[model samples]
Structure formats: C-alpha cells, structure tokens
Target: MKNKQEIPAVIVADAKVFDYLKEKVGERKTRTEAYSDLLDKSLAGFISPFLRKQDYDLQPCQCHVTISDLATEWHWHRATVRSFLETLEAFGQLKRTRLAKSIVITMPVQSGQSSATFVIQRQPDFAIQLQEVLSDWIVGKTTSADVGNLCGQVVHQAMTGMTGYESRHCPDSHIDTASAHAGKQEEEIRKTALGCIAHAALQRVLWKSRFDDSSPLIEFFRHDLDEEWVSFIEASKELAELILDTEACETTFDTDDDKERLKSLRKPFLSLLARTQEPAD
Candidate 1:
C-alpha cells in the first residue's frame, strides 16, 4: 500500500481556483465542504497521469487509487468514500475494477477527449442518492431517458417544497410572467431565489450528462471572494459555453396538478439520467 502520509500535501494550483468551485457549488455548501471538494478535484488531477498509463482499449483512462488513502486524506469514513466512488462509477462518470484490495478507476472517454472534465455537487451529494433511487425505479432494462425521467421527478420533488411561497401567491400560474404581470415584489423575490436554486439544480443535472463537475444551485461563485476561499473557483467560461451550446430536452410524467409546473424540467432531469447510461465506448 502506498504511504498515506506521503500523499502530497494539498496545494493550490491557483489560489483563485476555489472561488470558482464556491460559485459553482453555491452557498448551500460550507467552506469546509467546498474546500474538500476542490481538494478531491486537485487530487484527481494529480492522479490523472498515473491513471493514463493504465488506460486500455477496453477500459480507457484508468488509475489505481486506494480507498484507505482517500479516506485518510479526506478524513472521511472508508465506507462513505467507497460509496462515493461507487456512485461515481454507477453514474457512468467512471468505471472501477477491484484488483485485490486496490481500486482501479477508468474514465470511459476517448484518448483525445481526455481533456473533458465533469463537475457534480458534493454537498447535497444527490448523485449517489439519486442513483440508488433510480435503481429501484428501473425495474428492468430501460433506456437512459426513462431513468432520467425518474431522476427528474426526484429533482422536481426536491425543489417542489421551495415553490410553496410561489404557489400561495399565484395559486394558478407560477410562471414569472404571470407573477410579473401582477407585480408583487415579495413574491418576485421568493420566486427568483427559488428559481435560481431550481435552475442551478437543473443545470447541475444537465452537466452531469457531459461528465463534468456538477454543483447545486445557490449563488454564483464570485471572483472577489475572500482569499481564504480563493482556491475553490475555476474559470466558468467553458462551463458557461457548454451550457449555451447544449439544449435542454423536456419529458412528461404523470403528476398531481400542483406539480404541473415541474413538467418543463423533465428534459433536464432525463438528460442527467441519460448521460449516466451513455455508451461506454
């Protein structure tokens, strides 16, 4: 086993990198949570070269990483850490092989596409939880879109509670234009905050399809954040560009009348779920 102590001390590639993570992850995550997430990304980058050598035509972009080493470095439970890795694999973010006690992780991307990076929100940590939920929903072999629809419902359920205020105000139509026509500032503020959170969650789900870092919706990571959190942020131009280039797909599912508003997000939810089942080639 590699010496856990020898795992290079966490170093900031760019002090400003953290700011981007914070922005992407949202205020829903604590600085500690955000820092830990950034550290993982940093460690993954450090481990990438080693992983590249293990890449195979059948299992490309592979690397050997021990659960103990990760748990020790991250000060997390071994089981929890293992669960997270398994969840990543389950989500098709990576593939894992157990070589004795050591874990070999493979990125299922093409050699030329190795530059691709994936982001997922670690705080709400919904990926793994949602993966498990979908497992039950996926009774038999199903399409990625089907699983995605189920995942979308889960997201819709999560954001549903936040919309209570909006429902009380509009009752019939929660659309911003409807509320805007009525012109109520309190309702608008509530709706905007809720919208931001819902949108962030939806965006995170969509990004998951592309296999990049995914974060929950909260607030945009500000470039001018305190130096303490500076290492968390990364430039968002690429992510922003990706979002612009990608179009959202909508799906429909049966729901109570109250949840009719969530139908529009079916495409995004399905998109996230579908990405996980994408061809491994």
Candidate 2:
C-alpha cells in the first residue's frame, strides 16, 4: 500500500482538477480559493491506506461524515449534497451506509478508480437533433404545462415506434378465420420486434453525447445510473458507427442473413430495454 507522501503527483495535483472543483462548488469562489478550501476540508482526517485495505462492509472506512456538514462546507443545498454523495457511491468512488440516526460514508481506494479511461466527444449537433425529435412528437407548440408533458410524449413515441403494427383485415379469399387470426398475431410480433430495433436506435442517439470524468451528466442522472452505465455509453458510440456502416451498405435489399446478424448484435441492447420497462399489472 502506497503512503500519501509516495502517491504520484499525477493523481494528487492537476490544474484542471481545480477548475472542476470550482464548477461543482457553483458559487463566486475562484479556482485558487476552491482548491485551498477543498484541501483544508477534505484532506484532513481523510481515509488512510489501512482503511482502504479493510473489508468495508465488515470493517467500514474510518471517515464518517454527515450530509449537513458537507452541505454547509461546500455552500451547496442539503439536497444537492445528498445527491452528490449518492453519485459518488454509484461510481465506486465512495461507500455509503445508513445508520439508525444518520448516514455513514466511506472513502474508497482512489488508485482503483484511476483505472477507467474516458473518451470525450464534441457533440455540436445533438442539441438540434433532440429538439427536432421532441418537436415532431409533441404538439400544442408552447406552454409551461406542456413542458411537463414532453417526458410522457418522448416515452410514448419510443414505445409506439417500437410496438406499432399495421393491422390486416381478413381477405375474402382467405376463408379460414383461424388462419387470419394467426396472421394477425404474427404481424403483431413482427411490429413489436421492429419497435425494439427502433428503440435501440433512439438509445444510441440519446446517450451518444460527450462524457468525461468531469461531465455534469454524471451529476444529473447520477441517481439512475451507475459506473456500469459508463461502459454502455462508450459502447453506444461504437453502435452509432455500426449503424452508419449498415446504412451505407451497398445492397439495395437486406437479405435474411443480414437481418439475423443485425438481430444478434442488437440482442444486448434489447435486453437492457426490457430491464428498463415498468412491470405490468
């Protein structure tokens, strides 16, 4: 185990880190002041090397912090402090447990956290795309009330695009009603399957934004996402590239083989989509 003195400067000091801290602090504080304050507050009595080596669930980290103390120290709202702490826990940057009266936080080994590599992309076009897509699906052009309605509309469009099928009526030539019913069922299945494909495409677009260790998306959606979501976000960039490749395929018509290959590739995304669904009554 490396002592604090032996810890590399690369991990301990960076000018960019102070900029990030300043942004999170969200007040009039300058970068220098933020850095100085952060050092004063967080570094003293910080978790030691021995604490990191212990089994956290059995022998928790020695650092115990209250949310109110953090809120006051950081000049942030109590709710914001709570959310930030939860995000840290989700990222494996810290461990949090609830006691009978208060919350206990345990700082994790920072060296382990340095292993993640982040790729940042510049997304100048996504804001326009999101607005356009949302505009197309939502009606009644303007109202504060309608802003609340947009969430449902976006979800509804995704679900509709995923499950919509053109229902076919029985033809006179097909005298068998049972055969007609089976045909309808098959059509429904096809529609539902195609909807899943569309939903995957939507996801590829939605989360394909720029992300780094310092992204605010981590803070905002932190409650719903975890460190594992980072991998999914990274994979979506590759998925977007694959989508471009498929679109540019020279074949005018897709063969059964191509269809099966696409289905196999999308299986994981479809499974994730299933997990996101609300349980039915």
Find the candidate with the highest lDDT and give its number.
Answer: 1
Model 2, which residues run further than 4 Å from truth? Answer: 1-43, 46-61, 110-281
For model 1, the superposed segments whose C-alpha errors exceed 4 Å read: 1-19, 22-60, 109-111, 114-281
| Model 1 TM-score, all chains together | 0.28
What lDDT tens digits, residue by residue, belong to model 2 across residues 51-123? 4444333332325455665556656566656655553343233456665434545443222221111100111
The CA-based lDDT of model 2 is what?
0.39
Output the TM-score of candidate 2.
0.26
lDDT tens digits, residue span 90-201, model 1: 4434567676556666643323331112112111233334544444334335455755565555455434432443455454554765345333433432343334334334
lDDT of 1 at 108: 39
Error of 2 at 264 (Å): 36
